[model samples]
Target: MDTTALLWLIGAAGSGKTATGWAVFRELAAAGVRAAFVDGDQVGMAYPAPPGDRDNEHVKARGLGALWAGYRAAGVQCVVAAGGVGTAATVADFAAQVPGAAMTVVELTVDAAERQARLIGRGSADLVEPAAALAAAFDRAPLTEHRVDTGGRTVDEVARLVLDRVGRPAAGAGPWPPRRFPAPEPIAGERVPLLWVCGATGVGKSTVAFPVFLALLAAGERAAYIDLAQVGWARPEAPGDPGGHLLRARNFGALWRSHRAAGSRVLVVSGSGGGPADMRRYLDAVPDCDPLVVRLDARPDVLAERVLMRSKGIGVELPGDELRGLAGADLDRAVAAAQAEAVRLAADGVGAVHLDTSDRSPEQLAAGIHARLVRRGGGAAAP
Candidate 1:
């Protein structure tokens, strides 16, 4: 008999539990382990009762219990499950169904603001209220043995965390020690990852990009954080608003070459525009580099608060040109600009991943961006 084990990844909607579960299932297979990946949502959908009742605590528990039993009896060594395991009763039901099997639960969490953005991005309507309800319920739910903050982590990274906690069932099957791919050729000429962080003023593009840059550097990858907005303002002789694209391109090229000489392997730039046109202009600057564009966004209220504090030097950080008009006037303009920019980015179809920075601090936001970059295979690519 195979020593079967079960792992339940529990979290609220948009907490990335499902994706992480699938990633774990795939990795376990890659490591020469046979694991069954079960999605509670799919299981519940096997039979419908009340509309939207699939996620009901009792309904999910019943469905998951049966699903686990089938997998266990089939001699599967591992079961990676996600969804609908948000409460103590549901978890207990799973335990009851699979007798003599050691079960581990890993709870994933993210801020409400990010979850809202994710749900909205995926076009999931009528979810805000229910999602909120579930979030509050989970807060009061029983504690799990392992807790992971999936706020800014890639699916692979989160899966790795779960695997580390619960050792693989088929251990020492192959490469007792995992093999690593060789490092890419040293960044030279123009082959490097050019990460562009864009959004309207007061959206924290520079703040987030700088930290991501530092993170890459700390990880031993040569990286540079460039604020194109700052660079544009520094040179007044150039034509066009905030310096023309031609001049900006010239400056960026020189900066890249200099950074390359200094052993930089990645370039992160934050600016105002994040649409297809904006990306094209960046590629014009570094014609040969792979581009990964990220758009940072926040609710109007969040944007207003950040702009107001920064404009007035309320915070310890030095003040800059963020102060456009009178106190309230500047904030209003920023809000409008951010809203309009978001609309434009969506319309332009640049395919940039929209990241919400409403409740996340600069560090958290940066870490999320870095995780996304790594997932996209952006940090370093072999030439």
Candidate 2:
């Protein structure tokens, strides 16, 4: 008998694995394939406990075993299953129970601080201990898995990743003889779109990008911020280097993939200039999705002033000599380089939009972008 393909989503509590699993199920169903999902937690809840003993590992094991058996018997060709399968033993059990099944284990990671914040925000303080325990256990688990960070991603975005990895049809055919199935619904949450904001340093890109993010939030859209600059600067081995910036870009792309899989509609990624060659390298490793790439431009004097103001607000104390040495000397050169780079990026199918942010606040710049997005018939825009 042929066994079904099992896609197991493994992660700590609050890691968004369940949400990812649901998204994968929907995408498969939409492609006219038969798929089913079983929540491990729900199955665990139904398992029989020892007499007068609510907690028993043997009982839990039995529950998971039963769940696996049911899926096998039903001949489920595709299964999206999620829970805290954070051990080698559990993974082995799954493999043994489902013979001839292809298993894709998705391991979701989130920064500890962010995971704590999410649990608290959701009023599930009870999750903290279990989440922490799972994190510890995962470190020692001997499972080869595709890892996804869920710190700032939405459910839909993560789901797409899972689908790409595991939801492809077994026979590469349309869904089994169609009966009426409900139209796929987006998992409920705020949509955050990924927006890549690129330009040379001191071009007011972040100034423009942050406000766009805020505007999306104010417009009742959910959004998240990723400052690629800090991501680069934090690199200890390559501090103050351009390669650091490139690494940051690659990391951002990976993180961006997770967010896209979770279903974020708007994501503003800010950093210095990267051309089409850079973009091609990025798309080669990551999935392709069209994002609005806004290139902000400003005069030399305006850029210097903006940089100085930003530095001051952040408490970066610089002596007049050093300040002039760094900011003044680089202003004109940076501005000219950025303008040239923006044109190059435009040639790479980036759909770049140039915004002169010299005289505008971040909010104004973001509003301008919103207008452009609307005018472009909801597709990418070019300037």
Candidate 3:
């Protein structure tokens, strides 16, 4: 392929774009094609929207542009982006990001009943009506290069259709490798410190992790940050990898390579769920790493208040992510589930250290974590 290709998959809530995108990416990898993928919402994750870019399409565009530069340098052939951008102008904006690349927009659609059923089944009853409105908006959207009705199709079927429309490589019959799925070889770089912050929901994992990332940078170490939940945005998850734990780990491997090449000496990552086994599997995905674990915990009362506030979209730090898995009526259920998770994680001893986040500011925790890493890694702060 002389030119780069980009496939942008768009859809309303529960339309299965993420699942299909994951399938497409996996199919390409199996066919021996170097490719990259991005969950669009995850890349443009600024809390306060950039001025004039209400939906943050511009931010997403910039992010795609930057990430593509890295992928292109590393020999990626194409990129698959999936999200909800409802206008032709927005498509054009994203296209402008990768100049000279051939961009194709694939819109996934479903019948109203199917849409409502899917969203409701996903525990997002509140989004049923809004999904209809967005589906209608997509109906009127311009530059819709291709459209596929994903109503009853399996994710792989939809992915095959999408790949067909976008011109993917045909798998040749020359494979003779062993059946076992081996762990990925470590990336070709010196080992770096990987700080994984984890805990129950509303325990401020991301809040603390981001600050630690900033602290590393402030202390003169090249640092990068990733939210495991964001990378695992795919649904109907991969076989035997419930919660997309390994899938996101696989994605993180790609990101780890990119960041490591750019001289990152430390990586700060946060995730809300995943037990001990899931955590160790991620270490496999990101090889050549000196791993440090920090589990943030909060008082039951404080945790409950934080969970309720987030569900209600009050005093939330991350916009557009408040009611992700919780519908209006699921607030109490979410609170209870979070409380239970807190206890379960404590019993499992998932982290090397558990920090009580009930009263400390994120910055304070970050400072302490940074100091500990520096001492443990024998000058982790130094470049």
Q: Choose 2 or 3, whichever is better by lDDT.
A: 3
- Put down candidate 1 lDDT per residue, 1-383, tens digits, no spaces: 33568888888888887778877877876666656666655433212133644554444455455445434433346778777555576677667756677778888887888888888876775686678788788787646757777777787898898788767676443221211212222433556777888876677877788777767766666566556543222211222323334334444454454445445567787776444664565567566577887877788778777777666654323112455343666567766776776667656754467877888898888887888887776663211
TM-score of each: 0.45, 0.41, 0.58
* TM-score of candidate 1 relative to the true fold: 0.45
Candidate 3, superposed: residue stretches over 4 Å from native: 1-102, 105-182, 237-239, 315-328, 378-383
Q: lDDT for every model?
A: 0.63, 0.56, 0.72
Count of residue pairs whose backbone atoms collide, per candidate:
1, 21, 0
Answer with 1 or 2, whichever has the higher lDDT.
1
What residue pairs are clashing in model 1? 222-265
lDDT of each residue in 237-339, candidate 2, tens digit only: 2223344334444444544443444334555666653566555544333344446667676665665565565444442221111223345546555445545
**For residues 157-258, could you state the per-residue lDDT of candidate 3 as single tens digits?**
999998887788443423322222346676776787888899998888887777767667666666667787765433212345566565566556655665
- Identify the candidate with maximal TM-score: 3
Give the candidates in order of lDDT, highest first: 3, 1, 2
Better of 1 and 3 by lDDT: 3
